[model samples]
Target chain A: MADPDSNDTVISGVAPGISRSAPQSKEEVIVISHLYKSFGSNRVLQDFNLTLYKGQNIVVLGKSGSGKSVLIKCIIGLLRPDAGEIFVFGKNVPELNHFALDELRARIGFLFQSNALYDSMTVRDNLEFPLRRHWIQVTQAQVNDMVMEALEDVGLAHTVDMMPVELSGGMRKRIALARTLILKPDIILYDEPTTGLDPITGKEIIDLIVEIQNKYNTASLIISHDMNCVRLASDLVAVLIEGKCYALDTYDRLKSSTDPNVKPFFEQ
Target chain B: MATDTTLKKFLDETGRIAVFTGRFLNEWFRPRYEISEFFRQCYIIGYKSLPLIGLTGFIIGLVMTMQLRPSMVNYGVESQIPAIVGISIIREIGPIITALIFAGKIGSSIGAELGSMKVTEQIDAMEVSGTNPFKYLVVSRVLATTFMLPVLVLLSDCIALYGSYLGVNIKGITSWSLFWNKVFTNLIYADIFPAFIKTFFFGFIVGIIGCYKGYHSSKGTEGVGRSANSSVVVSSVLIFITDLLVVQVTDLIGYG
Candidate 1:
């Protein structure tokens, strides 16, 4: 994203009433510079850099096994990059101690590929896990309200009493998202949010993601290969190729890009 | 080369277990303890294992008495059967058998549960949810097993004694009070205390190894199955080894 001017143009028809933020309000929440990470001889990320601004969704598009998950993991301080700086909220993520990392994690919601809802717990308990674990002080009434509100956000308020196993695939993903929403995170990282769902369910999830983004106005770094998700939810599309952000632009602009590396994503 | 690889893997696993133990020790004493989860684990691990332990104990006691009857009659020492069975059960068989059963059941359960959680990213999700999975899962479970096994053994010993009483009257008449009196007259603290204390070691070995195998499980579904299988095998082996070591120590301490 060398040209700051390119991001000002919004892609329409994907999400209506999305309320995409003004360019002047772009505050950098996550900044990665010259990030390099590798495992054994496999280089997963190399000199990769990205910046996520507040109230914007940046979709990192990549093929499977192309370091998309690794990139998000590094951003969330789950994995330490081999080299370079990851400035998350002005703190070097890799440099922070355990306590600091945990504090940072509190503000970032990560929706895993598998949904990762606690199987042993009812939907209500799963949603309350973050709030209870973080030692958040709120009245029981307030907690109930918060849980209900998060469930309503994903439109699964009735499933709170049911266990995760009883829910369908899309329902479970929605419940997981509700759990993530319980924290009211400043940033949400979606790791292939639409990976396993059917096409219609995937669209609904993408719409819900956009709705959440618009409703909360939180920054999001979505890693996905799903073109619909990239097209609909992304305010800025970061094309990841060979362990780097190969191209960064609006989805429409990236769709029309002539570069061999960036054309396949938009070829549909 | 194969032997070398196997040895290296074993040493690596040993080192990893040591480090995991050290980590457990470090985090267990830290603040923000998971008290509720700990108690929940205690109930599940301790209270839930009662039925199986009791049934097994009863069978073992009945079988011991019946088997000893033949030998006792041949030596013309048939009247001493209760005392002999009581001494042997409390001193050795009771604790070891209960522990082996505990290892088989609890070890595999923990391994499979945690391994599934690991593979499905639930453990990682726990971390991201602002909870230390180690404290919530591993520490709670390990401490549960540590405290639960001894309690189970104590109860099992009692049940086995009752079963022995039933077995005694199967052939000949003996009053309940008389049977108990004869059994207790020969029993001493030396026979009981060492056996009771060794079970804590047995419990700790089963727990730590089970947790270690599950927590570090990889390779997805196959890895989870391997974790469950090996948790049982490793814990059972370690239980015997720990019993041997603890017995040696007890003997040196004049409790033998």
Candidate 2:
């Protein structure tokens, strides 16, 4: 049996610019410490700790059923952990009430694996939904400008009148991203940003992800298994194995490692 | 042991539904209500359902009058046809049938719509976007159904009465005034008010059940279908059960 690879440095606590103790800096957007979650007998996440700093893209890479999605859900306050504190903007996620959570969510964007665009609503309505929902008072002209700007960010300005069902898969994904961008969230959580598309489309999405990060300077926590997404988009890669952060290091460093557990992923 | 577990599941579901209802009530009066979406839902759920309800009510009234004419003639109460049919239709058949039709149409639509949204992760997207989905989707729908059913029922009752008039005219000459006078004479406040009141509850039950089934839908695409199917069946059964309770209450209050 191979020992779990704990030799790699944990980027969240050990990264040069960030302090290990008392994470009170405005730079740290999300700090998930000692997170443990399970459904029934299946322990999905155990002692998972990660800190996302401002303007960083952290890709959590894992195999299928490795609790990657669960981790993202926990960070977004969709699923409460059995034991842990997920501090987002100095407020614990699980501890916040509904209104407070809503307030926090306005500042945090989430790109779902499914894109999750509203099929019944047109593209313009889809983008306007969050603005109207959060009660962000703006003139119609301002809303139109904001909507167009978000669409322009994703290079889909012409799709405003189109329904989601009318768009192709990659187009729909862009629309979903545009909707997320409309809010101008400080932190964005992406769940499998390039799952169901072809290589070219997937690469295009990855490029869009980088472009958005560069433009907005938002902290992004992306959960993915796609190696292309991992290699291209990650500022740092956190390897999740057996419900724990087995290795947290750069993609190149982990790829060059000879450790049996981490070696197989690189070999693939 | 099996029975105990089944009973426990039943209680758990009931409690969960109650909580869902409570949340709706709590969120209803909050700021940033989706008034535009509410009207849009009303248009879809209520206005679009008018033709179906009207057609069904008309057919019921026509067939019922034709079927009852023979019995009335044999009993020498043929002239009382308008009063008898009007009383039966207005007091019970009209509202119940209209509500059932509304339930089958709007209830299933709401269930399938929300179920698909849940499966597709649209609801989750709304949540992460700082949108109140329960308020935007569920409350608008519930309010639309609750307020619109009574209006639909009233319209259906009128169409049904008109159909009954056409049915009556097929046999002999009956003036419009005579027919309407007979109907008004037999129809009392007790019968009209209680029946009207019950349809609101019927609408409420349909909307809530559909919302509950759809909002909590799991297991992907299969779950969406199951949510729609179960929403129809559950709302139908609950409509009857609630109608029974309403009848009991109204009777106790001397409405019957």
lDDT, each prediction: 0.88, 0.88
lDDT of 2 by residue, B147-171 (tens): 9999999999999999999999999
Strongest candidate by DockQ: 1
Itemize residue pairs with steric clashes in candidate 2.
none
Q: How many angstroms is residue B67 displaced in model 2 relative to the true structure, after the best TM-score fit?
A: 1.1
Candidate 2 CA-lDDT value: 0.88
Q: By how many angstroms RMSD does model 2 differ from the true structure?
A: 3.6
lDDT of 1 at A128: 89
- Worst ten in a row by lDDT for model 1 chain A: A8-17
lDDT of 1 at B182: 89
Candidate 2 chain A, which ten residues in sequence have the lowest lDDT sum? A14-23
- State the fnat of model 1: 0.71
**Number of the predicted model whose TM-score against the real structure is largest:** 1
